[model samples]
Target: MHSSSSSGSRLSLNSLTFSLPLKALALTVALIPFHTINASKAYQYDAVVNNNKLTVVGVENPSTVFKDGQYLHGFGYDLARNYADSMNVELVFTTVPDDATALKLVDQGKANFAITTTSIQNIESKKLTSFSATCGDLYSLQKNGLNTQLSWVFKHADDPLTQTASGFVCQGKQSGSISQLASFYNRNVVQAESWDSIERDLTKRMPIYKASFQRTAEKYDLDWHFLAAIGYQESYLKPDSISPTGVRGIMMLTNSTAKAMGVSNRTDPAQSIQGGAKYYDLMLSKFEEVPYPDRNWYALVAYNMGPGAVDQIQKRISAQGKDPNNWVNLYSYLDGNKAQNGRYRQAVQYVTRIRSYLEYIKNTPQLVNI
Candidate 1:
């Protein structure tokens, strides 16, 4: 009886050992389809290795990146193109709203890169991939100097040699030469140093010489830079630069316009700038219904030719079945015998200049001071 019991226990132990392998085999069989499905679902992005096709993403701001119908500019646009060229890839851009969103897209593999005055911080560096080389820092070199350090300068696109630098790139049709006029930057090319200097310069120049003018600009909710840009265009910031067309002072106020604005002295820098700022504010208000890009162009035309001319252009633009407030669509209607005159021609050129200048400021940290 003892021998029979011992044999029964041994038989039971053998059955349990055999059942373990069968369970494991069943589990293996159950997992086979899961493994196969996972393998089939695995996806790979079509990334160009060492190829020049890169997708860059950034914020969609006028200062960052904007589309004027089909035309595109701004530092972010230029930089993406440049970097792609360096890598021999065609650049594709996707515009977002802010840096945090942009970085998130990159991390999620929606875009390969992000560009928009991106600052490399410790936290950010660990979170996402960035260029080994720092980009978007603005610097200035002495006029006529050749130090590979990029500097910001205002130049006509038609100028002979187009200056393409780190932060600012000019596209123009003229053959005139360009020279840098200021060395407001340090030799250090790091992003931090460059950004710091630009902020410092901008702060120092933010205070307009006249407190009243500053107050008025604030009251009108106008950017002091837009006012400054107007001053720069009018007289190149020269308090006494007078146009051959009878415009005077830094604001380039015509005698009639000045008198209308109640400006007693068009030659006084403070008064002229204030008068110009006020006039611009009025023009901006008059076209409050117009779309942006167009509104800016209209304000410029009003500055150059007169509000009457801008109204005429709007009528022509409307007659042509285009939106009068669409600057990109309306600009073509402004050319030729219908509006062919030096005044209109100058207005066209001035609009382009202001657009480029605004683009330059938006991209380059160095020019933020202006």
Candidate 2:
């Protein structure tokens, strides 16, 4: 069945709902060098249509919207092109050095529109026309930099560096990619630390692991946010993290899974994130019959409790004529088993924390579905 959304509350697609609220705990601050920029001084968020014929956008990640040998590809690129086609306007792609420059271009009428992931605070200050949409596939990994984590950054397409993976989404709105992304996560994460602690120490290793997470998550056919949530749940992203049970490194994989994923050293951030993503990918494959989001939960539970344990539950659910694919149904079975309930709670909290953080980055404070 196709679904639509109300304009006041949503854009063009069905809303994504992950009901989890995690308390942002008391964090211990640590400083990490962040490559940050502000668009407040550079451009306004309002749509400045100096010429109806031209729609100029500022771009940071050109791979997202770029032309390759007469073929156009990228989420943002396609979005801009499609929108322009709908409006019967000419779309011009321009190179922008920074947010300030992009905003300045839009403000000075050098460009009709500037597209970048500029913070929301700056956008409001400038009162620029925002499409009121952002790409859910894009991730905002700010260090423990509160008041600095970042908000309201829109994506631009046509960067030569972005992967043209023959990806096709629901064909509308910023959430298209994000909705697809939601299919890759689950609620079976082990919550080892408070949100506050993760917040405080995030900056320390975020710079180190963020790129690796993105790279590995992409390779494993998962969203970076899913792996990131797991990383946070496992060790708060501490590269040197070692659990009491001896699960090692950022993604906290046991030595067996790590070695199987081609990780020689679990303590290595790159190895850990990549290995963990691969392991989770395998878990996802184990439950292909499950639906999205719920499928993600199944994958997560399997990741936490191992495929063997989850397989037993699935068989029992099937034997009882219950749906083995629905997370809620599967959870009902788990809830009845006292031995597994403890892990179920941890998984819920795990997914909740990650989803909450991802939701914040996906939308601005004004539009966040909290």
Candidate 3:
């Protein structure tokens, strides 16, 4: 196993940044791939939503909906889009600062469901709206493979970073029972900084690294955004970075992983990127039937948790009525892998965040077409 065995430290979705200014420009689009029932749709859509012009109130939550001013994503966006399409409506999306505001909009009938973890508890107090099926969840891994029992005391339904409930704060190697505890007890835990610090440090370096990403991605016929996103996620595009588990360089390759891919220096940016790309392609080859986008998403999960882990999840997905090759459906199935203890969730976030960043890169003026 790679040195980064501890799931908490390695699969830290809490570390993903959600800092982006909300712009007045509501693009009215659906970015994710869901079918549209109509062909006579209107015109001039930015994101990629339904046709009925449905409006939704939300917050800048990348965990559920990634709002980057130009585009809105995640379950909320997809839900609204699908609902609108089902009803033949167009999609309109908005973001606020907190969950109370979002839920209030829904409670008052100003928009659709609040569609957030925060909204879950607050809705009970309001009578104008009803909470539907578990719209979404804030998944946090106590540890990798401790025990996939989702039985933690899911207190603090809104705050997940401090994920503590009934004095059960999860720690390494002793957390396999967390999910079981949380589930039996019937609860779910809920859960950035930087200034120019991240921007200033990464500004100049992004171009050089993105160029590397482009080259490596093309060499393998892979999506440049994906290869780059993995590099960015693995080491924040830092060629010299090292992970706690001894993963090194921009791609965060473990020593054995690196050597197996013919990489002599895991710290070298080009060597690491290319090697990581090769490894990723190898993983992608495992699922030949999955369509694009979803296929890429599955491959990314394989890159993180191993193909065996992905295979197990896909098997469960197939067992369910959902399509195992479809990422969006498969993603929901991952949550059902109660035995994996949120490792699947880690992969889900890993892919979601990377795709969002890829979208961000495409929208960025300086970084476009790199």
Q: Rate the local accuracy (lDDT) of all candidates.
A: 0.48, 0.50, 0.51
In candidate 1, residue 27 scores what lDDT? 47
How good is model 2 by TM-score?
0.46
Mind giving the per-residue lDDT tens digits that candidate 3 earns over 1-370?
0011101111112111111112201111222222542334222121122333555555654334554333444433443443333334455666667767766665454554444545323555554333221111223222221112212111123221111111122221133222322221111111124424534544667778777877988888766765766777778888899867798989998899899999999988889999999999888688777644346566778889888987877787778764567654555555555357778667656765576555455455665543
What ranking emerges by TM-score with the best candidate at the front? Answer: 3, 1, 2
What does each candidate score in C-alpha RMSD? 24.0, 16.9, 14.7
Estimate, for each residue in 139-163, the C-alpha lDDT of model 2 and write its tens digit. 3111111111212222222211011
How do the candidates rank by lDDT, highest first? Answer: 3, 2, 1
Model 2: how large is the Cα RMSD against the reference? 16.9
| Tens-digit per-residue lDDT, 307-342, candidate 1 | 888888788878887567754434444444336577
lDDT of 2: 0.50
Which candidate leads the pack in TM-score?
3
